[model samples]
Target: MTDRTYIDIHVLHSVPPSNLNRDDAGSPKQAVYGGVRRARVSSQAWKRATRVAFTDELHLPAEQLGTRTKRISSLLARRIAARTGLDDVAAARLGTALLAQDLNIKAGKKETETAYLLFFGINQLDAIIDLIAERAEELAALADDALTKAVADLPVREQLTSGHPIDVALFGRMVADITSLNVDAATQVAHAISTHPVEIEFDYYTAVDDQKTAEEDAGAAMIGTVEFTSATLYRFATLGVHQLTANLGGDTNAALDATRAFLTAFVRSMPTGHQNTFAHRTLPSLVSFVVRDDQPVNLVSAFEKPVRSRNSGIAEESARRLAKELSRAASSWGVTPLAVASVYEPNSDQNTDTLAAFGVPHSLDEAIASVLQAVRGRLQEPA
Candidate 1:
């Protein structure tokens, strides 16, 4: 059977004035779309928030995640030292040589760091520790040069590539030195853009000096300006069920579980830029999950012309536009989705007939369940 499973998640949420993501100029990011300035949040920012949500909210165990950093050698060294009876310094030297020879990753300016950030799973690191522990006596007797040749043929690539770390599977990993270790990302996240034109606003604020005496100049403070923008944003992301399952070593069950967590986190997570000051955590006004068999449909084109407020507000209008696009795409292409679940906070009565056409509204959790059920059924089919 043909693998026809793609989960398309669409979000319509309005946020207050915030610097969720900033540019080099210390201003909220913006992009010119439809010949107008639209507030933008980079995909990288949202993806990071989602990853954190996986640990904090979803409570996934550490084994399912990957660590991305340049100090991978130091981290592996600590584990190697604990697993084997080697000292910290010896473990560090052995870890570096093995990583370089087997994985082709070289150390940077210092011996403790890699040339760039390396993303590897906990299971992958454990495999390295196991290899070191197996040859503890032989490797411990040799110096740096001898140790390098002793374990030169160990199959580190094979051990690290499998057991796809949940993070590496979704976001992907790049190995320039050893291209075979690179993992293709199973999902695509689009930079969120506002549905309407926006102008950047500045908040001029001053911090008062509490200890300054009134006799010595009354005007004593430091002042600064912060740039920000508030708008109803249309955020979009898609997950390929086939690609994700394959990334997980063809484990359909794990793929389904990952999808549930990924969708929930993507919809619920909010980036924290000046969160202590602004605390701009807003839930999506409307969220829709569409399981399409043909291809992933991005409804961002609906807002390409830029929606305007008439009776309904920007968020409400944004929802209607998205629903209409979903209907238009299905009718024009004659391709019906496998399943769809949409949940909207009905604040405004202003909506197109297509909103109801999207299907009976379900709660957020219920929507995720519905999509996951469809995905599970599809994966069970003969492939």
Candidate 2:
């Protein structure tokens, strides 16, 4: 069966549907993009909030979530053992040991933990007891023969020395697998570049305006656009059905099941702004997965920034460059899905020319709504 699995995510500064020129806070009263100033936000603030949300939900590293072995194993073990006959001590021992062995902790001070884990994972004690009970009749028959002797032959660590390492790779341990990461990024990007954008009401002087006249008058009033930094990102990851199967103890079926489950859970749980986490508003419709890096594709990450130049539209051009790099990265990893990141500055010029000086070009104000749609269309088409 075809994997038919890929993700398309975008992040931006803010979104406002209409108007031109922002106030002192760097938000758009309105500006021009896609040949018109629809509304605007900044990319940096969106990414920051979204990143924080993800870290909190997954207990991920302060910087990145969804890729650490310890975090995944510990989380998975607890989930698997829940309401099962297993106790906490047994479960922890199983999880920690399995993770240690999977990471290839051969010999060291940590070997104690590793050995303990291996024993629990294989359930040696239970297996030995069961075997002894089942073979009682055979042993009783052999007792009449003086030449026969009984000896227990329990396997030591040497028994598996010649065999390949135990499989311990669990899925859903990275941002890629956490579908919300992509969804949130896409949602943030949409918010950054929308036609009518939402702004946070942090000013104490501002009163709630529910009246029709107040609403009408609010159009020209200055407001704060959500701010955040967005970088051109390029990401690649591979799911080695073969290596994965070996890692899961040669159970191809189990590997496939786990992969499917992980992918589904990740996508379903993706987080976004104040609302839903996995907002599909800016998500691309079609996705493509290549066997290697270098395929011609249009989606990328938001981490990498391009070299600056004197060009006026360098930000969008940088996005194009990032798309190209994304294609290359996917081609480099056999059967992996990779994304590219394009830097975007949603608001007007700021005190620091960080993004502008770095060479990321700005977009026409209306470009936000269409960017994800355009990228999705490109990926959905056949090669």
Candidate 3:
């Protein structure tokens, strides 16, 4: 087995009548899995939700996160102007030149727009500004041709890779124009799908103008139908600890902190697709984390056969199935996890016996702390 380490997280959550993720027609997103229609939430949506949680709930430093945008020129221009004491016009011009030379990106019709959207962290932006200010005198003296050449020669890739943001390091970056700047994602999130077969249900209703009383207007002002579904969803995500460490330039502490933050945020965050219409804010009924030295395992196969709800409900059945599958996999594959932790909603009918059989923690706080410690212990070990 390889020495590389990995963290796998599994979650079982149930949402009420709500359209958490929708398609183009404003219907809940779905897919045919295991020969049955299953409600689906794209990985992108959950990832965004987790990122938002990082900011809103965890209160992580904004500078340690990355931003995705096509208007990178404008973002950099404002930073350049603030740092270099240059006017907006001059700073913007310099920012455009620096990006064009370094990233090989052509500005679009709009001065702020780039050829494609770019993902960058604050650290990278600061490095670019510093480089510009360092050679301000030289740049001021050079002609257009010489200035372009000098800017191109600057170590743009090196700067971007250093002091990388936690989110950027985890999610990764891809600069089509500059392949060398690309950072492979250290995390993987699977599309959350209902454990049981799902059928879309529509709610039809009408709106009467508030200003028009019953006597003023007998007819309704508007009418529409909203699609929704309620199901127990299976959400899985994995973090490649070795890759995360590499992405953060071998900073294991930062990787551990990120892992902890992600664990809490992912469990608490809820997608707001139709929150105004259907306020279905719910937490995971079950949460599990396994730190392994082998490979990342996704136990979604447990749900391949649709789960039938009993008196305990679908969420309880889903949790039991997951725990059983995980146990079986470990026994058959000779898998040995460094640490394992789990949490179950106290009031739920779900049985915690299966997870307890694996020596998993019952408290969420204990579980998170255990996983973080395990990661730190592994990193400190000599190869």
Candidate 4:
């Protein structure tokens, strides 16, 4: 068997004065790394952005992606009613009964809501709705307790177990009440942190009413202050090929496609927080893909001591540090990665020599293709 265990992606991207992610106080998030304050973008925010890119950039079908919401019961009830010729009221009652009895997922404070958000496949919902519709007449007439018990023995949970959505398989699902329904995530995304110390900056200004004259409105119609920061962030993510293939039901082709889509999402996606005001939609300057048989390695340690540049821009220096760190790590660990590919764009310009570890100059598309080629060769090798 091939010993490959993980595919790791490292990125160095720069964003202008923007709050790509914010805390409760409406200030940009910060993390003290290496004894210095660094601008931060939470992993959750980036993961959500990746999911959105699956639809917006890749245009994958609904069946390939899942929906996330707290009102899953209501959504399922509506679908069940539409497909089963049952009334909405009856569907609501029946939906809650079967879900509680068979799945053990109880309804929340709101009858049609769950205690937490559920991420599930679109096709999986249809399978469930159809399962309910199969015995709608009998199930609807039964008492709540009886309906719960009657459906408890059904194969409802199996529907959820099968046909895992790409996002669901990658990011995973947590069914608190029903542990059997949970899918282990195949990917790990690290929070993006600046490669240098950062200070939060504030933009304080006043807005004047356009229609009202200065004589009538005085100095201004409104006044406010906004917080933001700019930095070159070092981001990382790792994916387990084994876990992904298992989640995809041993379908290697599907796993490969998912891998490609994932690479695209992570490379291209951007968090949209305050995007309208700041428009902080910048691409990464350097991206490297590493496939390893050993454990995934993160290159964030390269920036443990913040990089400094004198008006030449920090991306080049940052890339130099990252490249050196990866080389040193591989040497120190005595574990060579199975394959590596990259596209470097220091100053938003692409090149091959920006990092010696990554050989040829490749566009983003070519880099993804390279990783996939390496993965397929390794996975398909004869044991």
Overall lDDT per candidate, in order of appearance: 0.86, 0.32, 0.83, 0.86
- Candidates 1 and 3 compared: the better one by TM-score is 1
Rank candidates, lDDT, best first. 4, 1, 3, 2
- Which sections of candidate 3 miss by over 4 Å? 134-143, 345-352, 357-360, 380-383
Local accuracy of candidate 2 as per-residue lDDT tens digits, 1-383: 22223333332222222222234764333334444333333333333333343445334332112222223444534543552335555544443443333233333244232221221122322232233334433443343231123323333222222122121243211133222211111111233343222232322223344654843765434344343322222222233333334434445445454334322222223223323311322321111222212232333322233234355333444434444444454466443343322334434433233332223332322232233233233222212
Order of candidates by TM-score, top first?
A: 1, 4, 3, 2
lDDT of 1 by residue, 264-351 (tens): 9999999999887788998998999999888888889999999889766798778878888998889898767888898876654454
Per-residue CA lDDT of model 3 for 1-383, tens digit only, reads 12488889899999999999899999999999899999999999999999899999899988888888888889888988888777787777777778777567766777569777788897789988888896665564566787777788777667776788888888888887688878999899999999999999999989988898666867889999999999889999999888888888777788788778888888889889999999999888888888998898899999999998767678877877888888877888878677888887544443557555346447888898988878887674223
Q: Which candidate wins on lDDT?
A: 4
Backbone clashes for every candidate come to: 0, 74, 0, 0
- Regions of model 2 farther than 4 Å from truth: 1-168, 171-235, 259-269, 276-281, 293-383
Tens-digit lDDT string for candidate 4 (1-383): 43457999999999999999999999999999999999999999999999999999999999889999988788878888888878988888877775676576765788667878888998888887777677897788888778777888767788889899999999999887789999999999999999999999998979978898656847777999999999999999999987887788877888899999999999999999989889899999889999998799998999999887876668888888888888888889876778889887544453435477766558999999989998886564323
Q: TM-score of predicted model 2?
A: 0.29
Residue 123 error for model 2, in Å? 13
lDDT of 2 at 180: 24
Which scores greater on lDDT, model 3 or model 4? 4
Provide the global lDDT of candidate 2 against the true structure: 0.32
Better of 1 and 4 by TM-score: 1
Name the better of 1 and 2 by TM-score: 1
